[model samples]
Target: MVQAALQYERQRRGLGGVFLDEIARIERHVSDAPGLYQLVEAPIRRATLRRFPFGLFYLEELDRIVVLACLDLRRDPQMIGVTVARR
Candidate 1:
């Protein structure tokens, strides 16, 4: 099992609070069902919540999962990467 960590700035965004809630939900799911998460590439992977327009991006490390950012589908994913790196 992999431990999970959320970036600080990403936690602050809240994105009207829904983002944080969704992230927590994802973390719980990941904790219970790590195998269900799909790889997007090195340093990044995504998991979607049913009926939500958002996706969670995370880094799968050997000991833990680093949640880089939670993104709304309408936003630019590239920019989100830059933001996560900056944080």
Candidate 2:
């Protein structure tokens, strides 16, 4: 979990910096017991980046989350899924 957070921070910096507050909000929701993210019922779903025209799609696993992709809003999300599946 520590490594994931560190990796997220490093990648976020390289991506021109994510909003700290937004990251905090997401982390809080994601980490909550039973989790706010659980309200999203799709097998795959979109989570908008607070101040960017991008989205993250993740797969929740038994013990870890797989971030499927960070995607441009203008692109087809289905394509992103296909791309991630190939990877």
Candidate 3:
């Protein structure tokens, strides 16, 4: 998110704010209902931002929620799968 925000800020002054706002909004949703969104796969869950092409990947633990990645959906699914597998 830091890198994406930096790039977004360079392109346009306030886009970073928009990007972060979307993330916060999603955070609120997650906080309210941790199991609201269905799991995309075992151990990981996904929720799409309202107007962005990006989506968040996360893991819900007993004590806390761990965000895995902010994915750019424009990328190829196969590439994304491989990239995430490495992590």
Question: What is the TM-score of each predicted model, taking all chains together?
Answer: 0.57, 0.51, 0.83
1-87 per-residue lDDT for model 1 (tens digits):
111223433545534355456667888887666557877655577788653566777777677777776666667867766765675
lDDT of 3 by residue, 19-73 (tens): 8899899988987777887687778787788867877877789988888788887
Candidate 3 deviation (Cα RMSD): 1.6
**Which order, best to worst by lDDT?**
3, 1, 2
Candidate 1 RMSD to the real structure:
7.6
Say which prediction, candidate 2 or candidate 3, comes out ahead on lDDT: 3
lDDT of 1 at 1: 11
TM-score-best of 2 and 3: 3
Candidate 3: clashing residue pairs, number: 0
Clashing pairs in 3: none
Candidate 1 regions with alpha-carbon error over 4 angstroms = 1-21, 77-87
lDDT of 2 by residue, 1-87 (tens): 234345556776643334445555554555443233423335654566676565556666678656666566677857766765664
Instruction: List pairs with backbone clashes in candidate 1.
Output: none
Off by over 4 Å in 2: 1-15, 19-28, 31-42
Instruction: Predict model 2's lDDT versus the native.
Output: 0.55
Candidate order (TM-score)? 3, 1, 2
How displaced is residue 47 in candidate 1, in Å?
A: 0.7
